[model samples]
Every structure is written in structure tokens, then in C-alpha cells.
Target: MARVQFENIYKRFGKVEVVHDVSFDIKDKEFMVLVGPSGCGKSTCLRMVAGLEEPSEGQIYIGDRMVNGVDPKDRDIAMVFQNYALYPHMTVFDNMAFGLKLRHFPKAQIQKRVEEAAATLGLENLLKRKPKELSGGQRQRVALGRAIVREAQVFLMDEPLSNLDAKLRVETRANIIKLHQSIQTTTIYVTHDQVEAMTMGDRIAVLNGGVIQQLGTPQELYDRPSNMFVAGFIGTPGMNFFPGAKVVAEGDTTKIVLDGMGQVEVPADYAKIARDAAGKELTFGIRPSHLEDAALVGEDSQRSSIDGTVDVVENLGNELQVYLTAGGKNIIATLDSRSRVVAGNKVKLYVENDRMHLFDTATGEAFF
Candidate 1:
């Protein structure tokens, strides 16, 4: 029941800077996710918060107190790691109570806390079992249970589900979400997976090259990305980018000369913004799902449509990905998973104006 704050955090290892002026506020009980690619400094940022690595500059606050010089244990936060880090010789119960034992908590109090955490995590039956006898998911649960017994104000997790199998990862992900809802601890989960961030975070902070690209709700980031990098990174199949220029007219009409979809009228709300970039070189972005099959083009009269050859096909359960080349550019369309489309076939796809994103070709800044 505490808020975590990073104020202008900066981390550097010698001459190479890892995190650059990163700052964010995690409200009490908020499940904030830190996400990016492998070298994006997400883990370094998390480590700074956990007191494992001090920031080169800036202050970290836990609740109302500045904790920049505080030790990890005194910060009143519990951490779960990618590895279970369980003691092989100790039973699950002992493993969970180890922290309390080291802190000199009374035996009776430690037992009660351990039992409660194990029960909450469905680890009651595995209490007598050692880490070796437990499955990967079970071992992970023990690790989480160890943290839960401490009842810290904040929970810090670093890819806690990465070690599980695909099915188990999904299950564990759901479990973690449910656990957070029940306990309502302020959680800061760090991971390189955008899917996990989208599914788990109340708000996701997108990072790149040690800088935050965007910080907003999942829908906000997906619908209105601040820049080109975020627009291409958030979605499943991601947004398709192409070279184009805005088309403006005398009567407030706006459009783009897309090589594949042709010139389609921009949505009325977007006309003013779109008109600002007329005749200028820019990048056009559209989500794969934003494009629709020509035959089922709904009431979206502002959409641009064109015919193209499907270069490749990816059949997923609920959707099919059609790779197409248009206007000398390669683009992907994610249509109904049931759509019976294959590679090298001609098909019609449409991209509505409102769903389109425009970015300056030179600066990569969003034009609309």
C-alpha cells in the first residue's frame, strides 16, 4: 500500500548510458509494467528501484520517503525473479519462512504467515515438498509465496513467468493478475514481452534505447501512439509502415495517395491534421487489423481500398495474416482468422482514414 516514484532517474556504466532521465509515478496498488527490447534498460531501471543498483542521478521514493540510499530490505519491497531461487534442501514451507527466520521473527508468527501465503498461492499441498520435487510452475509459486509472506508495501517482479512453458506461462500470467487483484499490492513488473505488458499492466511505459518512448494505458498507446516506434511496436502483428504524402483540397477534404489502397477521403476529424502535411514526404502507418476485406467494407465510407497480391499467408486460429506488396512497399493485413486466403493470391484490402497514422519521414514524429 505505497506509491513508487522515480524522479529523473539516470543510470550509466562508465561511458555507456543505459537509462536516460527516466521518471514515472506508480500509484498505490497500481500494476505498472515496464517493457522494451532486450537492451532497452528495463531491467536496469527495475534494479535501481529495488536498490540493487543505485541510479547515477535522480531520486527514488517509496511512499512519502526518499529511499535513494536505503538498502533493498529496508525499502519494504519483496522481489520475485526469473529464477525461482529456492533452497533445494528446504521444504516449500521452510523456503517461504526463510526470510522471516533470518529477520528473527517469532516461530509461531512465521508459521502463520507462511501457511497463509502458501494457501493463497495454492501451495498448501506442496509445503512438505522440496523445490526439486516441484514442477516449474510450482517452484515459481513458492518463490512468489516467499515474497507474499513478507507483506511488503510493493512487489517487484522481473520476468517471473519467463521460465515456464507456453501453456504454463499463460496460466501463470493469469494467476499473477488474479493475485494482484486480490492482494492489491503496488506491483512493478519488468519484462521484454509487449504481450505480457498489454495483458497485465494498468499502464505500460514503452522504452527504447534507454529512453521512454511513451507512457500511457494500453489502449491509449495502441490507439494514439506518440511516435513511430510506439505505433509499430504495440500491436500483435504490429502496424504496417509505408511511404506516402498527405492529400489536401480546397473544401477541407484530406486524403493520401497510397500505392496499394489508392486515395481515400480522410475522416472529418482528421482532415485538419492531415491537411497540414500536404505534398510532404511522410510515413503512413496502419494496423494490420485496421485493414478490412473489401467485400465486407462496412459503413466506414472514409476508407481507402485497393487490390493487391498476397505475398505470404500466416494462418492463426482466429485470424489470417496476408502479406501484400503495394506501391512498391510491403504491408501486412490481419483479417478474420477464418478468412480463406493463401499466398500469391489477389485480394482487396481497405484502410480507413481514422485508423491511419502519419509520421514525418525525417523526424519520425507523428503527423496526426
Candidate 2:
């Protein structure tokens, strides 16, 4: 029953506005992530929710109560910060039990809660170890264990896995996911990493310049980005952009013409829109994965193809990352590793016509 809601929230410091008109609801037992670059107001929003900072305008609700002025201790929420924040001298059990002890809980009850959380996080064997004795991942688990023993209605995690190494990050990520499934607590996680957002969140809120660009499930943001920013920011290598392109009708076929490169026949489904935009400048976008070596495609395939000189080829065992210059612009393509394409070679790239994207050059809004 611990659903969190932000209604038209805004935050400002002096003359500078940070968070702008942000509104979203995190349902009970849902895992939500606030993702963006540094200074994007993601951490500020989380702080507002935690009662560490108050919004300049709008209401914040946790469950049935409006908690605008509530103290962090009274918010019925547990927060795990980027730093483990453990007492260095205390053993794992003591650190986990500290909060409960501060509130003067019965010794037996405190022991039971701490032991249960320890077991949940697989820290039973390390109960006697101090924070300095534990590894990065282990220390993170202790932080999580400390939060869990509270059995709070909501959990707020801010970049909890960023401190871990790459391999440990993956392992800790899985552990957090498993922990969420087991407890079913309403959780809001914040991170700058899209991979973490994609893998951990049930829904993601993408923010930039203190504004939320889009809020939806990860797949929705990926497959159907509402604007150029979300489209470019969500993917790994990101969607490629060809600026100042134009759409025009040549006979019955509508083609997107890129200066100095070539034209691509627009798919039938998008022909009308392309036709309507004829002679006007637009940005064409396509993912690297959608481009492939033309030689490998069947000769009779209807894929629109373009030619580019390969600048570099990165063989990644399973796939090849090829960087090429096309139409006076740099383009990246993820292709099959077995293909013989190499640096300094001129190669034809097949574009997945149906997967192409168009955006208004001025506003950076998607046309899909």
C-alpha cells in the first residue's frame, strides 16, 4: 500500500530552477528508476522524495498521506546512498542493528530482524566482520541489509552499484533484482547508467536539464522514443543521425536524399509522411544494429543500401563494430564478425528500411 506520487513538482535554488514540473506515480511493489546525466536533477528529485529537500512547488504523497514537510525519519522509507555509510568500527550485525537500537527496540526483536535481513542478503557468514574487512560488493550488501531490517514501506537507492567493479556491478545488479522480487517493496532507484536502468527498472523516467523527457517502460522508450534526445540517449552506441536530409518523390517512390551520399527509398508505411515532408530538412536516424554488410544480404533483398569507406573495424568475437564515413558523416554499423569487411575497404551497407527514424531538424521531435 506504499505507492509514491509526485504531482507537478519543481525545485529552484536562488535564480536557478533544477527540477521542472515533474509528475509520476510509483505503484506499490514497483521498481522505478530515475535516470539521467549528472546535474540533470535526478538526485535532487530523490532528495525531495526522501524529505532531505523540499520542492519549490507541488505536492508529494507517500501512500495516503501528503508528506511535504515530513522529516526523513518519519517518511516510512529507507534510503541506501552511493557511499555504504557504514560505521567502520562496527561489525556487520551491529551496523544492521544500529537503526533499530537507536529507536530503542527490544533486544530480542532487533536480533531477529537483523538476522533475517542478513540471511536475506546472504551475509550470515560475515556477521562478525567489520565494514573495512568486507569487499565492495559485500559492503554494498551490508548497506542493503541495514535498510532491509527496517522493513520500511519504501526503498530509495541512489547509484548503489556504481562503486562496484564491472563484474561486481553485474553480480550486485542481479542480487538487487532478486532482492526486489523477494520483498516486493515500493522502490525508486537513481543511476546515470542506462544499462542499469534497462536491467533493473520496471519503468524508467528519463530526465535532462531538470526536465523529465519521457516516462515509460524500458521497451517503450527504446522502440518508440518520443523525441531525438530519448532516442539518442537510450541505446548503447545510440541511434545515428543524418542531419539536413530531405525527402522527395521520384516517380512513384519517395526517397530520403542525403547530400553527397545517396537516397533511400522510403518504406510504404512511411511514404505518405515522407511525401508530406518533401523538400524540407529532416534528421534521419537508424541504429547501428539495423545496418549490415550488403554482401551478406541476399541479392534480391529489398533493403535500401548505401556505400561507405570503412575507417575502423573492431572484431568483438560475436559481432563486428565497423566505423565508416558516409555522405560526409561518420556512421557506425554492428555487423556479423565473419564478414570480410575491414578498415580502408569500401563496402555497401544495407539499411533496414522499416527501422529508420525521422525527426524535425529544428525541434528534434520524432516523426515515427
Candidate 3:
């Protein structure tokens, strides 16, 4: 079926555990991303599947076979690395055909495969160019063509776009998505960039401190993260955190007590849970996009508002990223460009009541 699976996987280097009991499955033709900060053991996990590193415990399966003891060459998988790794002296066509040449494939067959991959990656016109003559994006496509010509059951790409310029990264990212749709190859991609993980992956496994924090579709991770780590790490600018928040019941309504800021009344549907969590030290999380200029919100009683002093305002043409401090906690809010809020002024930011996230302070797990 060309599905990749990891069962109770563990990796240790010199008695220091790195990957701990990690397990996940990449379905056939699925694009699964392994993402986290550097030194999170994500590359180590990919290396295990590629047979470059043996796991300290448990098993790894490619398609249905346990490949723990198999040599990398025999694993029936193709890998594209972070670096282009193209031979400076070789032409794009030659680089793409190198692996086939090593296997002694028929000359006509090698040419056919290389030509097909080159066409797929839009490198057909640049096949005769050497690595030094090509741009970073073209070299990367040559690397992709090399992997494509193999037609392996799975494609393993490790930060393949990291070396490209920002504009090229965006263009190449779209190209990779289109290529995946065309080939329908099972892909396991690794990157430290969450934006890449969010946009490119069919599903993402977020790793941190050598362990997986959460695994799900992009929307699931964004809208309902399992814990504080996932909530903070998955978004740009991360999520705003208000630590030491408390939930309290006041007569018919339940409210979240933000130390210096006034209490936020809980919605009727969430009142019961808020009451149950009352008196505990909790963390409140809200995305920058969820907070808006209170003036733009008029006087909606359904939404709550908090007052803060503007610390900074970053104008990005289409929107304003306002940094403010409320209740002694720093917060960032994405507001409309039309808002007149500026630095060093008192601002009231309206909160999207339904978008708020509550997390357990001690364990970092999300309550809702």
C-alpha cells in the first residue's frame, strides 16, 4: 500500500533519549510533514525510516515491510535532502540519470525517465545546464527530478526549500504541491518552518523536545490544538499567552479573571466547564487575528473587550500587527489597517469570544 508506519519508536544517542516512543502512520499517497524546531529529533526520525539510523526500540515499516535491518538502497524509497547535492560538473540531465546509471538501467529507459521527470518539474528546457549555471530554484527542481526518476514507493524530503530565497520558496512550494498531486506518491516531508508545514502538508506531526506534541490536519491543529505547545507553535507570531488566569463563578455567570484586566464573562455553553475549572491557575490563549480594535467592533455585548497600552504597531499594507500590554501581559493583535491605533497610546481590543483557548498552567494541556 506504500504506507509508512512507526510503532513505539525510540532513538537514543549515547544513553540520552532523543525520540521517545514516537508512533504515527502516513497513509498511502499522503503528504505528511514532520515539523519542529532544530534538535527536536525530527531528522533523526526521518533517518530511521530511510535506514540511515537504526531505532533504539520498536519498529519502522515502509509499505508493509519492516525495514529496520535493510540497507538504504534496498528500502525502495527516494530522498531529497536540504542541500541540492547536485554535482557541479554534471548537467541536470546527467544528475537526474545518475541513480539509474548506478543500477545499470538501459540507456533508452534512463533517458525516458529523466525526460519525464524533467517535464514534470519544468526543467526540460534546463536539462543541459550545469548546477553552477542554474538558479537555486532550478537546482532544487533538478534534485526533485532525481528523486522523481526513481519512482520509489515513498519520497522523503528534508527541508528541501530552506536554501531558496523567500519568493522562490513560495513559487517552489506551489510546484511541489502540484507535483505531489500529479504523482500521487506518498511523501514524508520534514521542516522547521511551521508555515511550510501548514500549507504543504495533508497532515502534520508537530515534534518538540524529541517528542511529538500533536498530529492532525492543518485546520485541526490550528482550531483545536491538543496543548499549549501546539497552540503556540503552529501559528505565526505564535499564540498570545496570559498566564496565571483564573476561572470563577459569579452568581449566574462564569468569568475568566485576568489579573489586571477585568473579568471576561463566559458564554452560556462554556459556563459549566468554566465553573468546574474555577480556582485553578490556568493559561488563556488567543491568536493575534482573534483580537481586533474595539472601536471597530462598536458595542457588541456578545464579544468581550480588554484595554491595553500599545507598545508597537507594524503596518503590513493590508493589516496592522499591534503589540500591546494589558494586565501586565504582552499581547499581539492583528487589526484592520484602517484602525488608528498607534504606539504609546491606550487601546481597547475586542476579543472573539469563541476563539479563546484555555490551557492548564502546570501541564500545558488545553482545557478547551
Candidate 4:
């Protein structure tokens, strides 16, 4: 395993720049995920590391060796693509051994590596099966096994699970995580799915518009996102955003006023950061999970309450997602699955003040 680093990496296509001074370090044996929406330059960044695409400017290093001018085959990296790029006619064993055979490895060594990879990937029983005969999940395992047998310094996976069914995707995700744990290979994964990024990576770099927006652990990005974009992108249901919000100091307390909705009372300690921003438009953010039905909350709970007309309710097995309009802005609340709330019902929701996020209206930067 080896650490990977990008030093002020920049990539351009003719006159249009796609990657702009992107830089980050992936420690030895660490799993790093590059995640963002489509056309966000995540795949381009990964290609650069794999030596498939050279950076227009800046340097990339695998271990301590600069690899900007190196060929992909010389980069000591193995890539697993989204399509599971397996050979149709070749058996699983041959597919995994193909790389080693091409490198002119001894027959015994190639067989040993292929068998070991098949065992590690739980494809031992399917070694004789062709790609067409195997299930999607099995085929993906073969793809992984092919990479594993290479014993490369780094493993790069680009949306390797996107083709699987939802249930199979979850299972494969766990399988990949287990595989990483046992082998502890340095991995750089690229995906548009935030859920995949959150669960798979030891550290995630959230990218957008060809730039790294934030890089942190899953919980760090979820709990303390650097800005409005990070806040809105990292969560499952996404945070509810209310623009044109005003904060007013009221003696020992502060009132966060939402036009046409109502004001939430916050203690001095929580509102101190907004003291000087009174009357200035600010963006208010609250995660759906932080909002709960007022009736479910204890009377002494410190949460402030707001009333809204429930517009929609979604019942997942363990929780209910309720969408409502409060203060003239649409918002979502996650509540107990036992909640009886339904569309058209007028309900009071309680917000956890300390858990709320405040951002600048114009720049979208977080205030606290």
C-alpha cells in the first residue's frame, strides 16, 4: 500500500478547465472517496491518479514517486470500473489471472494469486463460471478479484456498485468494506452517491464545480459542514434552508424571525454569534432529523416550536419523513414512524436550536 498526494493539480480541456488546483493527501492504507454530482471532475481526478489522464499542471505522487509522466501500467495501481469490465467468454479464474499472465508471471504464481483473490472475494465456487453465467454481484466480485490479484500499490474504484440492485448494492458495499479491512490496500474511490461515500471512505473530499468543497470524516461533514453547499449536500434528506431570515437580540434572549412563519427563542449563548447580524438577511438551516413532532417532545425540552401545514408524509419502516411549509418555506422533518401525521394536517414541530446552522445569505458561508 502507498499514500497518494495531489499537489495543486489542474486539468484543462482546450480552453475549458475541468479541475482547478485540486489538492489532497491519501494516507497509506487509507480509503479516500472523491464524491460529487455528475460533471464535478471527480472521475477526472481519479483518472489523473491512475495515470490514465495527465494533469495539465501540477504533480501527482504515488508513494514518494512522481507519476505525472508515467504510463498507467507503470503506476502500480489497479482500477475497477463501474461496468465490471469482465471478459464475456473467459472463466472467473482466467479473468483474474489475465493481468498476471500478461505481465509474464510464472504459471504457478499466476494460479496461486488468482486462487487467493477468488478466496478473498468469496468467488472460489464460481471460478469456472463465465461472466454471463454469474450474477451482477458475482461479476463485480470477479472484477474486484482481478484487481486484488494485481497486488498493486493502490486500488481505484469508480462507482463499482452502481449496476447492482439496491439490495445487492448494500451487500456489495459491506463486502467491499470487509475486503478493504482485510487487505488494507490504499484505495481512492469515486462516486456520485453520497451514501456510498459516507459509508465507504475513511475521509471524503466533496467536490463541485471542479473544486474541493470540503474534506473530512463522515460525521464531521454531516455535523459541522463548512458552508451551505456542504450542509445541503452531505445529508440524506438534505437540510432545510430558509432564506431571508433575521436575528434580533431580545434582552437576555434572541429571536430568530422567519417572515410569515414565526420567531424561535434562543438563549444568549446560542445567539451571541448573530448579535451583530440583526436585520441582515441570513440563511437558516436545520436538518430533518433534528425536527420532531411537538407532542413527542418533553415539556421541558429546550427546543423551540413552529407550526406548519403538513404537505406530505412518507413512512419508512422505522421513521416518518414529513414535509411541510413553515414561514412560507418548504421544510422536511423526520419523526417517529409511529407518528400519525398526514397530509393537510396542521402540526407543531420542535426544533433543536443548538443543532441549527446559520449561513451568510450572499456568500453561503456558515456563521457557526
Candidate of highest TM-score: 3
Candidate 3 lDDT at 124 equals 86
TM-score-based ranking, best first? 3, 2, 4, 1
Q: Is candidate 2 or candidate 3 better by TM-score?
A: 3
Worst 10 residues of 1 by lDDT: 294-303
Report the C-alpha displacement of residue 46, candidate 2, in angstroms. Answer: 0.2
Per-residue error (Å), model 1, residue 58:
0.9
| lDDT by residue for model 3 (224-282), tens | 99999899999988899898878877789777777776556677887887777766779
Computed on alpha carbons, the lDDT of every model, listed in order, comes to 0.87, 0.91, 0.91, 0.90
What TM-score would each prediction reach against the true structure? Answer: 0.95, 0.96, 0.97, 0.96
Give residue 204's lDDT in candidate 3 (0 to 100). 99
Tens-digit lDDT track for model 4 on 1-368?
A: 89999999999999999999999999999999999999999989999999889999999999999999999999999999998788898999999999999999999999899999888999999999989999999999999999999999999999999999999999999999999999999999999999999999999999999999999999999989988988999988999988988887767778777777655666556677887766567988889998888787887233377778999998888999999988777889999886788799898888787787888888888876
Q: Write the per-residue lDDT of candidate 1 for residues 222-320, one digit (tens) a residue.
A: 999989888888988888887765575756556676654566667788777777776578887888888877766665533477567789988877778
- Give the poorly placed runs of model 4, Cα more than 4 Å off: 266-270, 300-303
Kindly give the stretch of ten consecutive residues in candidate 4 with the minimal lDDT sum.
298-307
Worst 10 residues of 3 by lDDT: 298-307
Model 4 lDDT on a 0 to 1 scale: 0.90
Q: Which RMSD does model 2 reach against the true structure?
A: 1.5
